[model samples]
Target: MIQKLSNGFKEIMIETIDKLKSSDKRIALAKIAKTYGDGGQTAVAETFHVSRDTIRKGSYELESGFPITDAFQARGRKKVEKGHLPHLLEDIQAIVDGQSQTDPSFNTTQLYTRMTIQEVRDQLVLQKGYQDADLPTNQTLNTKLHQLGYHLKKVQKTKPVKKIEETDAIFENLHATHEAYQGESNAVRLSFDTKDRVKIGPFSRGGKSRVRVEAADHDFGQTFLSLFGILDMSNEHVELTFTASKVTADLIADQIEAYVHKLRSQQEVDTLIINADNGPENNSRRTQFMKRMIEFAATYDIKVILAYYPPYHSKYNPIERVWAVLEQHWNGALLNTQEMVLGFAESMTWKKKHPSVTLEENTYETGKKVEKNVMDQYEKMIDRAKGIGKWFVEIHPHQCKAALYMGLKTQ
Candidate 1:
């Protein structure tokens, strides 16, 4: 383009562009560049001692006849990612989000990340195949992280409700036993729990939205629903059951029975190791739950291990992680109906796979307890883990069936 122009014409073009305002100067330069057709920006940029990006922006303005309102242009600086590496933001999200998680309480949308800026830079090199020299500086990486809604602060290793006297020991025992079972071919390790009840109505959820009209100022939803989730640890397969009824001991056991049936149908599962917290319904001391589970084990002839996490340490329950993610998925919108709630939950992904959701409409009676004499029969079958009776209990299929056979000893 510059080669075709006379010295006088070249001088005129430069003078006119330099004299005009930012928007006008870009338009003039782009018009001249346009006349040269494709690859004109590079030639025009070189002749005018301008950046190729500037000429590119000018070309866009020429076509649209409007100044660019992009964040990069409006901010008065080109984003490093947009200008140089288009995959920079994607790689950053991949590295940090893999190590990050939603808050356990579902109180906030901010992810509780365990990474620092320096660590992210290290991970980019280690995981994303980026050369140390090619990577952005620590400050730049931190800026990018914040832009991606990642809060760059120290997060606890795992959010615990609080430290109990038996927290460490319980974790130690659970890990040791869970791993032992996980390694066994005949054992199927599971983490199961119920989420805190969600009120069904147009209530105010503490999430920001772009909607003009918002949820109700007060929570007036009298109807509540409970979500019971059973997770298969080896494969990321999860089944969620939601009910309008109170989450009772029977409902908990019923879900377990349904899952046991599914496992029996699909593959050979001799042992089902379930990880749970000592919640009100399924605690180790809950006699009704114990009796029901014993019956379930005996009927299926599958060994059951009722592994409970320590008191106040419900965060250690693997299913709680799924609940955290589900809450995040359903947060921003108004879950005003049962269908909406189910739809949102069904749409959420765990490990990039959707969960199997079912609405169990059957109402369950609360306060259902096992009588001492009946519990005594069930107790003959439960093998508590040494001193931690409330944390761990094992039920052998044959022992359970034999002891409770005809509501009396087999003998």
Candidate 2:
């Protein structure tokens, strides 16, 4: 019977003969014999630049008829000392199971630190015969742990805020408005909001380095400020006005006026639709002021439409999104002083990646306090009316007109 050579087996036999002719045939034979078991043939051939058949032939010559035993003995690299494979495996299992009881997520470092070599040795002495056990070193344990798919990491739990009931309505309104603006040739809808009572300057410091250096020297003081901004949906222009007080309807009006004038300067039409939340300022006891604002807008043939998002749904506001971006930019990091805070705040500019409207800090004098009567009137109107228009029309009897006037002159 003729033995038909498998693919590349003849080439391997020729290569094995070449190795046998080398100065150290025994060493070469041992290497070739090692390759026969498992998937070692390809690896041995690549390592020694020989063929698989050459390795197979040399392996056959070395073992003769005791193929199974010879191949098993030649498998992998020889262990210089083989004292306790079973004991080491047990120790590792014990450590893993013990840690799993306390913290199922315990990583390799935690395991290693918690289970010392002496402790493991003691446990082996008690559970099994230590004389026959070969304890693994920390490095070996770490490698083994990794091989077992154990790794160190920080597990974090995320708690996202639940969507309020009003969010859907607000989002719906925003989408409708956005679609309407897209269809209109020249009409623009601007979303405006304020970051109220944001402390300016170095109100807080963060980071490990900052914490160490400014541990005792840091001065924590509050510098109240407001960021009033308008986002023009048409051209994506953002106009910001910074103030040093609580945001009120008057301030909102002032910003709107400035925005309108700027638009007019750019030859843009004055037909603007302003959207805001139903805050006290928006529905203050300023009927005359609101009326004037409306009449003034009418004079310019500009229709002022006020859109209010539902209660507890402020997050639905586009301006709220802007604030979120700003907050992310300034999150947890501290500014050393008011100047630093202002610089940092002013330094914030929008880009295509995180597209935002730019806000410039304009230091306006505060001390402007809204009267209790105005608030009371606003409360009454809000209480009597339902939905968005209730406050503007019912809260303060004549306040909407007054706000209009204030908005017009300011514009």
* Top TM-score prediction, candidate number: 1
- lDDT by residue (281-337, candidate 2, tens digit) is 563334533534444464565655555666666776677776665666664556545
The residue ranges of model 1 lying beyond 4 angstroms of the native Cα positions read 1-162, 210-213, 406-411
Candidate 2 lDDT score relative to the true structure: 0.54
Error of 2 at 124 (Å): 61
Cα RMSD to the true fold for all candidates: 19.6, 13.1
Give the worst 10-residue stretch by lDDT in candidate 2. 388-397
Off by over 4 Å in 2: 1-178, 205-220, 284-289, 353-388, 391-411
* TM-score of each candidate structure, all chains considered together: 0.59, 0.44
Error of 1 at 341 (Å): 0.7
